[model samples]
Target: MENAKSMEYWLQESALICEFMVFGALAAAIFVAVKFERFWSRGRGKREDYVYDNVLWRPCWRALHPAGLMAYRAIVFLFMAVVLAFDLHNGGIHIYYFYTEWTFTLVIIYFGLATLISAKGCRQLAKNDSIRNQDVRANFLKTDLEQEAHVTESPGKNLDGDSVKLQSHQEREEQKKRAGFWGYAMQIIFQTCAGAVMMTDIVFWFIIVPFLTNEHFRLNPLMGSMHSVNALFLVIDAALNSMSFPWFRGAYFVLWTALYVVFQWILHACGLTWWPYPFLELSTPWAPLWYFGLAIVCLVCYTIFTFLIKAKEKNFPKWFPYAYQRLH
Candidate 1:
């Protein structure tokens, strides 16, 4: 009996140690991320590095239009929303207590935000094309007038050329500049979701669904797809969209998970009796190992996604020079 009591004491102490370590690591990551972001913003980073073509949807083929991308986002958002609603109706508000629900909802929010951004981008593209066409027609008329003057032996001072060149230069600079506030928000959210969906799906399929499924944690089609579909949709979106994924953004993913952990702690403090994931329970001596392992998993997953983005950038231009838009 004394041994059992001693083990319990050690387990509690170990859990506290694990919790502090996790938070400390997260804090360090956030500090580094902020420092890097500030450094990059202060003109040390390439403008293209800070800028992303989130508004444009460059497909694998030229035939697919940006509108098609917007449509795709809308459809995805609607489908995910329906699935989420159905799950909530069946499972009640308590489903929000799971990390799966939080990640799934974040995916839904991304698609919705992406849809709006894409639509706005497409509209802007159309308007610019229309203005360019009008300018072409006007220039054609001016060119004819100059030709007629040349035939009549009259001098024509074409002062518009220099102004036209200056105007085009300004426009190009505007294009190269970063897309505004919403664009960055979408990009950050995209990176955050990338790491999160990966972690959620990996833990759910290989860990929870296999070992933890019981009367209280039953697996169903909707629940299973909740784990898989988020990643599938995100992967497809990444392939279609023209956005650069930077490794530094992994800090946001870590912070996101840390926030969820803090939320769970708050709930537990308020008399919640159960943990959503078994590894999260602090009653075992293995809690520190589990916590540390998950931190490593989070880093690994983010690195995997960043590698995929790099691969896409390297290969897409070689394979589809005309169709693939380069983010850099």
Candidate 2:
């Protein structure tokens, strides 16, 4: 009995130490992400590449159009919404007690926001095309009149036209550099969804489904597809979109998990005895190991997605030169 007591004491102490270590790691990662973002944005006064075109423009391929992208986003958003509604109907509203539901809902929100942006972008594209057509007609008439005059254009007129063109180009550059609030929000949500989706699916398939045998937690068709569909839809969108996947944004992903963990803690404090994931239970001596492993897994999941995006950017252009437009 004395030895058991001693072991219990040491286990509690070690779990405290592990908790501190995990908190420290999260804090350090957030600090690094903030510092990196500041360092990059220092001289530019704005994010250099977080441009409107990244979200607004369609793939440069002749077959792709902004309207088609909008339609795709809308379809995914509606489908996910329907799935979420059905899940709630089948599993009850308490299904949200799981992180899977949270991440799935986030992905749905992302597609909804993406659909709106793409629709707005499509309208803007049409308006710009109309303006371009009108300018082309005006320029053709002006050139024809100049040619008919049989008079040489003055050097001053040529210089003025050149100056106007240069100023217009500069204005467009400024516009591109200035990403508005919605643009930043879209990018943040995209990165967060990428990491969260990957982690949720990984944990569900490899860890939770295989080990959990309880009738309540048994994997069904709806539950099983929920685990996979989130990642599938996200990957398809990522393949089609021009948005960038910066490594620094993985910090947001870490913060996202941190928020979920804190939420679970709150729920447990409020008389909830059950743990959504068994590893999250803190009563055991090995709880620290589980927490540490979880942190590592989260980082690994984010890194895997990051590497995939990097690979896509590097290889897609060479493989599908006509269809894939490189974001970088």
Candidate 3:
């Protein structure tokens, strides 16, 4: 009873730390948004000028364009539902109910708040641009006949007889050149971090846990099945990461899986199991077959996840970042 109490106390403390980390991340995200707004506003001479100034920020407002909002909301809510289901299944309410309820609760709350703020910013920017465009049109309409005749005589003759297209093209080229080295570096870092987290979670769930649990290897059908299911999810997670960021997908998954296997082997040799998964006794040749089958299942799961992500990208381009723009 005392040991159980001690374990409970430790878990409570850990959960508190996790909560702090989540809030810290949210705060940092907000800070980044504010800084970007300030910097862009200063550079563009007006807040509205910075709104449609960059292709990178286009995803935030893509939801407000036609049916995009419905898809965005659906995907986010589905992800939240999955997280909630996992928490409930893992006894989240009972275990951390008293000690860290607010921590887990705040994750969803903060995410929603951030999304709403971004959407509002996009809407305000759009409205401002519309008003500015109207003002420009009115000025053009009031121009004297000679001025209008000169404008129409230009080489670039659109229905509006404005040279706006050439100016827009030139501006795009300038913006591309101005996106310096630091921007590219930060993009790579962010992508790498996301990939690393997904890979770590997979290693922890499948390879580390199963290899460490003795009961998992004893072929107790129920335990074996549960372990299999957990492993399957880890594989799916890896696949999802790869699909979401396709540029380094193959390299990240392959390198991380190799590293995780090597680490597990070293742990096994030392008679130390850092994860909770049960390992099969190596004495039986059939053990290799069973493990191999689990590996195949993982591969299949990855394939399925890749297809799903591709479909999602087609439907909601804003859901994921553009790897090329982000990296360069």
- Each prediction's Cα lDDT score? 0.77, 0.74, 0.38
Q: Least lDDT summed over 10 consecutive residues: which range in candidate 2?
A: 1-10
* Candidate 3, backbone clash total: 4
lDDT of 3 by residue, 1-328 (tens): 1122233422454333433433444455444444443333342233221322232223323223412432343355456546656657755454232111222233334234324433553574576567557755664555554466776554323424443654465446534433234332322332333333333334435655556535322434432333233334323332222112343233333333334444444444455433233322232335445445544543454455455546655654455554312211
On TM-score, the leading prediction is 1
lDDT of 1 by residue, 1-328 (tens): 1122244533468767877976897898788577655334553554545754433443444567889989999999999999999999998999988988998999999999889888887787687668766766676677678878677633333335634764586457645756677777787889999999999999888888878876668887888889888999999998888777877777888888988887776776666767788787666778789888898889888888888888998998898888776545
What TM-score, computed on C-alpha atoms, does each candidate reach? 0.87, 0.84, 0.36
lDDT of 2 by residue, 256-295 (tens): 8877876776676565667788787666767788888888
- Between the candidate structures 2 and 3, which one is better when assessed by lDDT? 2
Better of 1 and 2 by lDDT: 1
Residue-pair clashes per prediction, in order, are 0, 0, 4
Q: What are the runs in model 1 whose C-alpha is more than 4 Å off?
A: 1-11, 38-43, 52-62, 151-171
Deviation (Å) of 204 in candidate 3: 13
**TM-score, cand. 2:** 0.84
